[model samples]
Target: MWFSVAIRVGLAVLVNQKRYQEWTHDKLKRFLENGIMPNLYYAIDFTLDEAVLDVILIQGVVQCPKTMELYTGPTYIPNNVREMTLPGSPSGRARPIMLITTVMRYHLPSDLDWFHQPLTHYDYRKQRATSLAVAHPS
Candidate 1:
């Protein structure tokens, strides 16, 4: 079976905004000192193995005790627009929460046994509905 896990990254906006501004200002200042406007944006790539993924998943999400539902929402991509939510604390205080999420696609092979059988029909709609129900419980 193929499964997709969503990973969400959280960041504090208001508190970090000043730091970001200062960093940007410093970068711009350096550019000005060099007598040139910086052509912004740089790309970097890194690879991870299964062990790394497992560690991250374990650290990031809170597992549901009864259902064992793994909720790993978005993960931040260095420079990308992300969704923000207001999370309420135990004290009923709300704070801004920024999240960038991505779905991790993987597969689980089934054993060739009587208990494990493939679906007779490939009904994507039915599968999607089931997945949605599982993801969002009433």
Candidate 2:
């Protein structure tokens, strides 16, 4: 069943040393408790030849209220290769990186009467700063 699969995946993530199991668990717990299911995305990086994979989860949502004639757009999953130079490489060598990603996005209905503006980029930055400030206040 899907629930079993989810539980297994969750357990695997929790046991994995590199994954942020505590953060993931807290986010999922808060979402369930608040009755707000924010959009979730996953970023997976893998090398087919080496059978290595790295996964990251991203949480996002369109707007606060869903009853306000909001539109839920189609989800997207994309895979691409990125090239980056080494930090201290004098030869200017570049490395190929595999980045497999998915995004969840919501679009507001065009007929909504209220102000309909996309969330600003700075909003996320501000939110992260605020979270850090609250967690470790000066």
Candidate 3:
């Protein structure tokens, strides 16, 4: 499933509304200044079936002291983040990097609304699909 891919690729999902707002706002400013496309921030509605986690994703290259002693390329630094275990994963299965709840509407950021507006005139009952593969971790 696409969810498995998200786990493997080191993408993060921010469940906290306040933290998400602060983090996205800062990233947006930097992205505009650099002329790089802004990362997608999806607003998911879900029920928390278990405990909440303290997940944090840092920006820029990260250096490992252990790897420095080994034969590693200068550009080959740690960039992937896999924090927290999934709530109900089987004991022996490969633990997922992140936990995700059941998603309802995959909403877009109002900050980027000017780029493409959502159709408000359409009926709400219609089935609409969004892709998680396009979402960015940073």
Whole-model lDDT per candidate: 0.25, 0.26, 0.28
Per-residue lDDT for 34-65 in model 1, tens only? Answer: 22111001101122223111211211222333
Model 1 weakest lDDT span, ten residues long: 36-45
- TM-score versus the correct structure, for each prediction: 0.14, 0.19, 0.18
lDDT of 3 by residue, 9-122 (tens): 222333233434556645633322222111212211112222222222222222233333221111111122222112222232222122222223233245533247554432
Best by lDDT: 3
RMSD from true fold, candidate 3: 20.0
lDDT agreement of model 2 with the native: 0.26
TM-score of 3: 0.18
Q: Which one wins on TM-score?
A: 2
Q: How many steric overlaps are in each model, in order?
A: 9, 0, 0
- For model 2, give the 10-residue run with minimal summed lDDT: 70-79
Candidate 3 residue 3 C-alpha distance from true site, Å: 14
- All predictions: root-mean-square deviation over Cα? 18.3, 20.7, 20.0
Ranking by TM-score: 2, 3, 1
Ranking by lDDT: 3, 2, 1
Error of 1 at 115 (Å): 64
